[model samples]
Target: MRRLTKIAAVTAVMALAVTGCAKKDTQTSSASGSSDKGGLCASGGSGPKIGLAYDIGGRGDKSFNDLAAAGTKKASEDLDATCKESEAAPDEPDSAKEERLRTLADAGYDPIIAVGFVYTPMVTTVAKEYPKLKFAIVDGAAEGDNVTNLAFSPEQGSFLVGVAAGLKTKTNKVGFVGGVKGPIIDPFAAGYQAGVKAVNPKATVEMKWLSDQADQKAFANPPGGKTAATALYDNGADIVFHASGLSGNGVFEAAAAEDKLAIGVDSDQYLTAPKDQQSHILTSALKRVDVAVYDFAKAFKDGTTKAGFDVYDLKRDGVGYATSGGQIDDIKDQIDSYKEKIVSGEIKVPNTL
Candidate 1:
């Protein structure tokens, strides 16, 4: 819920980084965590060296990339590790990411983390070349002896937020704005719609994808997010939920302007959103990328690291809904009841429509 410190994803230009090489534009950061409320993140000792590559939005997107940054901070605290990072440009090709990964690897950073699924190819290819080094990809898959996949059941969290939206909607009309439509994003839309329909069968869910395929720009375009959410609000949706990365910032803007409510994704956006937009955020679907990232680092440090998929589901507390701004206080118990049912197998939350 704390306001984030990472810079916002406002431009397409970023600096390149390597451990031994000179940094351009100073985009690289010595991995650090968001402020620890009680100063709990004080460095304990020297630990592992980390290399992080962010998604297009990078850190400061106040959503996905920031959460990944939080994970590095956590790792820095718990493991007292040193970290270096590089970001992706707005429309840069995959080659750019591969080069970044190569530089991090070349710099001798162990257990390097790639912050998005787009890095699957790079990680799969790069990990093969660096057999002695460790690699992990968030929301991606790759075959290698040193690669691990940090995946999450984000649909479960989306379902929880959808429940909030469904219970809170005044007009019985809700909308979902997806940054892109694909295997990773489809579940968000499906779980949201399912949650809405589950609570209010008569409710109508207006769904739209900013992009039709696996386009990275869809998640970066705040203007598109605003336009999509604005149109939905104009069509009578009183509440909207977005799974559109940084673009969701625009959704919050539209919601505040239209005097409507919105649900955020990845992080507890209510705490990080601008003061004006804070009141309008119903809640955010919590995807604990931070925990997963830290776990991967810990595994690597402890020498138990393995190459495979690590899935964080609702039962694992890896996914849930936020409760900031007290917008859904009265209905929290109702949402918890649904969560219990889901955990107990009483309610089957579909990952797809």
Candidate 2:
């Protein structure tokens, strides 16, 4: 529950970074595991000091950022290390992101992790400047001598939930609401469509996007998500799946209003959603951000961390569907069978529509 501090300093550094002359800050937060004194994060310890910079919507999204935080927190606790965290400012320039990275690096936090794809460019530029600091970028890849790219097969997990939607739907029609239309988000829609067809070829799948490419607000616009999902439900869709980050919160609300089902993405929404809306969340497509982040931090501490691309896919249990509410109990066997096929390469989940 630690919050980002020194906003004025961060804003100043961001401005300076844009001009290529940002001065480093010497201040540090308290250590992660320690409750009192020394700071939120201190430098030069036998254990690692990890820095986690979250994507837009940050920790309270109940989705992606929360998962990232959970993983980093677990790793820090396990190693008895300090973990300083930062969140993205809405529509901030790429330079601001660089400043955040610089702030973490300057404080001697090694194995820094950028928690979203939006950080690819910033990470690319900053990782070069901090060549000695170990870095990891989730959901995107950036090359550097000390960088590790953590990626997941979103399509693989989306397909499993899609199967649940397909089998559970009384109406043959379903819908998908995406945060933005792009390669990053397309896989979710694609896999959901593929799974629907696989389960029932005649089932109709409707796809919609909350915002077009370049509109960063898409991921945070819950109202837009609600409106879109509501429209789909009103149009006769009994089930809806979303890959809309925090925006997906609105989708859950829409489902409750329409008395329909929703499939969550990135985390187990059935468990995270409000108690009233929890039942509407049939399942969730899990990307296991926590697991990846924890592994990266632990590996770095063990001195076995390596730089380069690391892909997490179905075979590695990096992505899957949650069955928290037991709403999908009847179809669990079917979904499990398909999961085996996916892992064994018997089924090739489509990454694109």
Candidate 1 lDDT score at position 329: 97
lDDT of 2 by residue, 1-353 (tens): 01111111110000001011112211235433212211333233346788888788877777877787667655544665567778777788888888888888887778799987767778878999988889998876576888887877888888898898889889899999998776678778888889988998879999889888534558898999999999999988999999988999899999999889999988787876789998898999888787888789889988988887777788877888888888999999999999999999999887766
What TM-score does candidate 1 reach? 0.87
Q: Candidate 1 at residue 353, lDDT?
A: 54
**Candidate 1 lDDT by residue in tens digits, 229-291:** 999999999999998888899999999999999999888888777899999999998888888
**Candidate 2: minimum summed lDDT over ten consecutive residues — where?**
9-18
Error of 1 at 308 (Å): 0.8
Off by over 4 Å in 2: 1-46, 214-216
Q: Superposing all C-alpha atoms, what RMSD in Å does each candidate have to the true structure?
A: 8.3, 9.7
Error of 1 at 121 (Å): 1.3
Residue 92 deviation, candidate 1, in Å? 1.3
